[model samples]
Target: MFIRIDGKQVEVKKWDTVLSAARRAGIQIPSLCYHPALETAGACRVCIVEVFEKGWSERKQVTACEYKVQPDLEVYTRSESVLKTRRTTIDLLMARAPQNAALQALSKNVEYPQTIYPPVADAGDCVLCLLCTRACEQMGCNAISVSGRGDTRKIEPPYGANPDACIGCGACARICPTGCIALTETPATITIWGKVFERLHCVTCGAPMMSIAYRDYAVANRELPEDYYTQCQECKRKEVTARFAGLSMKVHHG
Candidate 1:
């Protein structure tokens, strides 16, 4: 289907989000909590856009990331109303994490002097986007989640304790938009959620790979080859490329 964004008609496929289509068409719609690898989340309203559907006299505001493309969908990425709403939303986000580096970087978008709302205590860069929690579940760890509600809301492993199910995969920390979750890794150890796990290494190159817990979980679940983690991915890719090149030369000579 074709959706009109900023007066430009862009062809979009099924399951395409308005944000993805706008991005594909070179239209800029800023978003914070949206990741292609993770599920669609409209938690951060930074990508709000004004939509003028057929026969609608006034524009309606919606998040571009979660908004599905529809027939005759007219989207205005920089409309005045949209900007006004975004300005307010950004102000609120800034207040949520007053010293957050990500929100500070986002301040360049609009001319909002400062937030009028009171700042929360000990509120770090965590906008509470829930990407980390969602990612944890996606990794099959399900180790962490948001606890409490309202101003007392916080993300933590059960009872704010170290999680036993976490494999120290660092998926949650890697996907975190605002550096909310902390992950520390060394050559032989990985630490997160107040737990420490031994790092796995490639037997061939002695290169550090993933945590031992992650490898064990994956191997147990998928029944991967015993030597699957013996070599690092780089070494395996090199070996495959060498074999392919040798085969190609053999074919050419034959």
Candidate 2:
């Protein structure tokens, strides 16, 4: 299918969103909550684009990540209105997470106005982007979530207590954009979200890897041998190497 973007024709495939079509045509639209691995949230309004229809000469604004491309559709990536909306969105996000270097860089790139509001207090520089929460859910933990509404909203376990279901896998910390989730790892333990977890070490290299809770979770969810205990990743790799070496020796003898 073909769509007109910024007065230029762009080719799009089936099920392509406006952002994807624009990206295929070398357009860059800033977006925060539109990860390819997660479902489209459309929470961040920074990717708003203008669309024009045949019958309606007037253009309307819509988010590129959630809006699908249509045949003969007219899209504007950087219209004056779009830039204004993006600037306002950046400024608002900056107020929520002034310490976020990524948001600061984006604000500079977009030339956002000085934030009228102060940075949110007691948030640990979190912007409430939901990236960490969504990542945890994707990993099948669903350990963390957003609590409260509006200004009081923050990421936490249920009822502001330690989660029994959390495996200390660090997926939430890894996906967090603002680096809000703090994770500490040691050979014997891992600490995250105000809780500690026991870690499993490799048999051969003695390097700490997955947590015991995570190993148990994997065993319950995935198919594995009954006798399999929590072996660290390094030991598993060494076992594979030893088996390969034995096979090579047998072949040479034969």
Candidate 1, residue 126: CA error in Å? Answer: 0.8
In order, candidate lDDTs are 0.84, 0.81
Among these predictions, the greatest lDDT belongs to 1
Task: Give one digit per residue, the lDDT tens place, for model 2 in 47-91.
Answer: 888998779869999999999888899999889998888888888
Candidate 1, residues 25-112: lDDT per residue as tens digits? Answer: 8898988888898898798889999888888898789999999888889999988888888888888888879777777777667667
RMSD of 1: 4.9
The weakest ten consecutive residues by lDDT in model 1 span 245-254
Clashing pairs in 1: none
